[model samples]
Target: MIRINAIPLIASRTFLPRLPRTVRQYTSYNVAVAGLTESQEEFRNVVHDFAQKEIAPRAEEIDKTNHLPEDIFPKLGEMGLLGVTVPEKWGGLGLGYLEHTIAMEELSRASASIALSYGAHSNLMVNQLNRWGTDDQKSEYLPKLLSGEHIGSLAMSEPNAGSDVVSMRTKAELKGGKWILNGSKCWITNAPVSSTFLIYAKSDTSVAPSKGMTAFLVERGFKGFEVGEKLDKFGMRGSPTAELFFDNVEIPEENVLGQVGKGASVLMSGLDLERLVLSGGPLGIMQAALNLTLDYTHERKQFGKKIGTFQLIQGKLADVYTKLSASRSYVYAVARACDAGKVSRQDCAGAILYSSDRAVEVAMEAQQCLGGNGYINDYPAGRLLRDSRLYTVGAGTQEIRRMLIGRGFNELATAEDIRAYNDATINGGVRGLFYGIGLSLPTHYILNSRVTAYRNLPSPAKAFGFVMLIVPCMTITAEKSGEAFTRSQYEGVAKRELDKEAQIEHERWQSLSSVQKLGDWARRHKYGLVGASWVGSLGVAWALVNRNKHQTTSQKVVQARMWAQGLTVGLLMASALLTGFDSSKTEDPRTPHEDHTWRAILESDPHLNEEERKRLHEIKRAVVDRKEQLVKEASNSVSK
Candidate 1:
């Protein structure tokens, strides 16, 4: 046998080891999970290592056999992952939704199917128990479920009630001392293996589902309860979804998860958290796709050069990176909101809506990058693509999400104010007249400049910005009329016009963040300040032009004085306009326009009647909601 000098051959000039250390280091890429706290990042790293060593090795086998990895549940329990959001006192890790999200992302990156089953157990069942279970109920089921001694799942969707969960046919009737559950839940994750199940059923058919439904904790050993045949799925096969049959299953009164006739609350609340956490699975799929593409692009060659070097390939990869980054950022921000107890229904929907769609696209692109290899089962890229497709149709379809988001924004619009911030006489009547005369001119000039910047904005945003610009001019005319002028009278006509324009533009201003809305309003109004200055400058120029034509020395002196005052106001407006260049600037040295926080806007008119006060309160609430939206968007940007 010839040794062939293997060591020397490996260390030859053409080998990578023979390359300069700096060259090697510079060529390597560094990728890290974004938007995570120190502890979260550490947890993610640990989970990544665990998934790579244990889950990835078994993923192929699990998929081939279509088996749920029952052994992994105990291991997850040992890692304090089974009860991620459960309180420590209840035999859990006492972590938040954000941490749970991190674990989900890392695990799903290796095996999406396994992660699907894990999500069904940890979030759908365990977290719901923690959120609504009575003390005795918690003590009875939580320990076993959290310790992996018992598997858990949730049953909500039925054959005809997937997106419209309220239309479910499942029912629980009170008979004697026990409640009897009838009807079946289909497409339930972990159904075949779950030892504990949180089931939703209608207790009162007379009332609407929003009020008549109730949640119950059902044990697998219950007399009439049975797991139906395991579902044969095209993707996420190892999760082992099945139909659950409840043939007069018996439940004690104490088994009710939340108040009777109020199961909708429990269901809705859990759905929000469910959306946030399940988002991590799609995020992980995107990440896995990106990772695989990166490696393949570096190694695969075409035309004697790496295929990744081509602009088209680079473009595809860049898009994948951007999508993954944005999705991760948005999901994490929503998870943080869930932890802080400041979550919004629309945001929960938005997070899943955005991430799920992007993940599918990113997975497809990843497979595309691999050419023929990605189409084959030998590579995991095909599997990632298959798994990612589930998000668009699962956990409420994209259509449902769109309608919910639109409805939420429309509600906010119904409550929003349609008038200028403040409209009142200043320095008695003289100053108000001067403001009316000069503000419109400078306002026009400033507004003209802003047109280009807002041109690309959504039609609603553009219309809003336009209406905002003209409000100050309208207010000036109203205030100039003094006590005889009611801002409401002028506002009536202006608002009608604004509403018409908004309608024509199809503007959904309510969708904008509070900061964004404020910015647009301010930018539009700043032109008034500019108009004031331009009016002065134009006046001075006119006076100077006709200076020699003055009939008397006094008139000449008066013209000179007019020119001087115009110079001052003109200079003031110019400096103000200069500062206005940055639309984000919320502070102004001369006026309170920049300082118009939602609180300040609310306080601008505190002496209103009851009806006005209520309207103002609604407006204030809209502002608060927008601010939260701004925070979430900002966090997403920073994370990216």
Candidate 2:
């Protein structure tokens, strides 16, 4: 027997003991999980050891029997793994989300079904209670649930309302000092064996769907409350899922989980954390698949050599390993963010979305690596594949995650733009005030010359000039004065016209199908659009210039071609700008400081923080002082 250190050498940054070449060739070592403290590493090892010993052996049996081992819950409770995020005063380990995520990942590596059940109980039920439950409700339910003496579950989904939770028909009516729940919830995890449930119901239908919902604490023994038959799921067989039926189930006022009409807030508060922790399930499954594939590739032989020796097999191994490492790193990074109290909806959704999709691909690759042996139940690859598919549909569907991420980015960009606009307005006002004072004579001369020219024009030209120039100047003056005078009356009318045009454009864009949009893009850029357009215009001009019999000199023709080519290029550039083709998208528009006057650069960087802006101002002052000193030296040299 050989002994090897299980701690990851990379994580500890320590030297490893040298071993014989033969020993090193046959040994398989563990890669250190990153982003963990010493205590977190120890906790992970403890959970990993327990899971392999107690859960891995029974994983096959549990899958086949479609039932979890009877003592698994108690054993997990005894190890204090049941209430990972609960406070110590509430009979839990009182750890943060990172630790909880580690526990989920290790357990999932052993048995995904068991890990799913654990997450549902620990995160969905226990953590919610810890966060939102009243003191009395906590005293009554937290201890039993935390100890794993009684099972817990959360009910939010209905038969018709899985992704659209706000459409749930579960109504709760306040009647005679009690709330009566009168609807059903389906596809609930741990429903068959759970003793307590955190349920949401529509309390006030008059209000909006989000505002009308209320969360309640209901027990299994409540009158007219019953758990239906367990669902025969495609995967996660051992985690019992069933429908819950309620017919006039009475709940006391004290059992309300949060405020009467704030269930959405309570539900939303836990969703990001839930998504973060549950992401570990997919990470574990990916690890497990990689593990099975590595062992089989090493042992299995083909064509007088090990299959792992083949280039194709080695490539597959590399791909899977890279994916697993990348996914693990991303998940851990997001978990750390969550633990640091920087929970972002988009980040959480994005973490699970990316990991879950990759897990499926990794599982399929693992099965492919095993070749014929992968398809059979004898190998765990088939089970891993089935389990890996559940995540993209379970917490929230992949589609919902994408939409959430898009909306989050849209909101962030809009807020940033608004802030930039406000900053630009303040800076522009100050600069305009100083310019008006310093350049008053030049500004007045320019305006007076334009006015006199307009007055000298014909009646029709004068009317057109007034509409284009005079009205715009007047509007600008009125807008700068906060639109406080007579021009303010027409401001609303002009705004309405602008809004109408914008709405028409928006609707036109929305009406185009995705295929149409793609086709339009292709047409717009076909045949190197700008290049071809400019070249074609120049060719036409050249043809016309050569065909002219009146041109007696080659110099005039040469000048004509040059003017035509320059005009064509300028028009192409202008068209590109108007069509939103930004040629400098990769470059920061605010950069190349030497191109702008110092004041211009300082005015443009409104996105910089106050400290950064102050530093920039100091640099500008230093540059000005240095230039002034250089000028003085030059003057003294000339005088001498």
Candidate 3:
């Protein structure tokens, strides 16, 4: 049998060709297998073997008893799975997110409940501490937690705060150099078993909810700290979840995780990675379900033949396989992106959202393939189905995920529009500045006007003029409104011209390959382009100066116009150095029409009294009527 280190040697010539020579010397052929490098695949294999041999055997018992084995964490620690993403100096494996994801997937494949608890301990607690904890905090907490001598958990969700965590009621007040925490956290995973807890509370409620919060490291042994009864969960039964009570719990100032009043930043820093890692849980469940179904299908008989041979069973099997493959690919891809420090919030949410939904469907399909056996607890399919459902609700609900993804896309579009509008305003300001300068040169030097006359005006008049001139130049509203009005007056002519030009530009852009397009964009905006324009402008200016000495009156007038044109063009080119040009369409800044639906109105102002609601409805009706009347009047005018 080949050892783990020897994997690269066997396929060095064939599989290592695509990789860099340095990387190929160190990497393995598994890069081509499942997007894993040698080290990642090797780590995955080790975790998988340990999980299948140890945890898989106890999964059923853990589910039935609603308790994970006492020795489970220690075993995991021994395997270096607890700190898969932590540095080796902290008694961890010093691996990256992909390796951590693989470890989670393999453990979850054995027992999802155990995996849930593990994720809470390793990621929600340990990883967060590693990131935000002070050196002393890390030194104090990391060793025991990593060694499995103590469990860790993060407490953010309170009784009234889940998705809206900022609205949490837990409060912490500093009194005489000690923080007094008085509040409770509910639905906290591993709360019943954890030794160290990362707790967030409102440290200064006078400020905004998000800004006033603080995170503290609380020990289970702290005074007045209590863990309430373990929750009776329908799924993930073995994961010990409970409410935590803090009553006059005193914490030292050094115990503050990160800075006080910056808990939101600490909380947000880990959410994307948290979502990416926990996504592996659903993926593992899907794989487990598929595996159980495939085995049962091959062995179990129906209609005098193996059920796997039947077309319907084969179709179900194929669907499960396809979903598992797709979900795994997405999870792995996201994990790799996270490791590369290129995380996307929407993609992170999307990965969990898509995988969790697909996992539920796949789990149900797995049970369906088992026919009668699937519905019973003995088959493990029922448990898989139950476990799979939790993912949609946990780590923010699927509804929250969908909303986040939608908001992310909306923000992206809005940002692009804002960027384009800013670019247009800057370009317009540059043109105005150059034109003002060009006009000023002739007015100040040639006309010989007295500058002191304007300066002698009253201070108020000068201030008023400055405000009027600057406000219009600084704002985009006036410029965009003017452009819109001009287009409206010559609508047909402008539309035809714009459409023709747009079509030609679109065709030209589409004809270029992606690489060519990038290169073309680079060439257009390069410093060399600006330098060439400056050189040409200088050449024209020199020629105009030379010709002016020998020119007739009309020729001199033409030379002045040429100087103005050349100066304007040169300044425009120089402006390119200051800002990027965006050709993207800018959105109009008009307010959108109000929602007329009752649900919309209720959501917008949920606390509205009956009288207020009636008044709002009446106002809405009047607005709608006025809009319709305007439309009718416009139509009549057009007809006339």
Evaluate model 2: give its TM-score: 0.65
Order of models, best lDDT first: 2, 3, 1
Ranking by TM-score: 2, 3, 1
**TM-score against truth, every candidate:** 0.62, 0.65, 0.63
C-alpha RMSD by candidate, in order: 22.0, 24.6, 25.7
Worst 10 residues of 3 by lDDT: 3-12
Tens digit of per-residue lDDT, candidate 1, span 599-623: 2332223134447645534544553
- Between candidates 2 and 3, which one is better according to lDDT? 2
Per-model tally of clashing residue pairs: 7, 0, 0
lDDT of 2 by residue, 1-640 (tens): 1112231222102212222122223322233557575568789889988998899778877887889676888889999998898889888898988899989999998999999999999999999999998778888998888778888999999988988999999999999999999999998999998999999999999999999999999999999999999888888888899999999999999999889999999888888888999999998898888777766666566776767899999998888878877887888899877765568899899889988998999999999987766776766888889999999999889999999899985652465655654555555555555554445445545655877764465777544543454444444543564424325435655888689767865786688777545544533453375457556765777776766676544543454445455565465445434444445542322345322333233332323555765565455455446545655654554455
Candidate 3 residues 251-368, lDDT tens each?
A: 9999999999999998887888888899999988987887776666665665678778899898988888788778888989998888755678888899999999999999999888
Among the numbered candidates, top TM-score falls to 2
Query: Which residue pairs in model 2 clash with each other?
Result: none
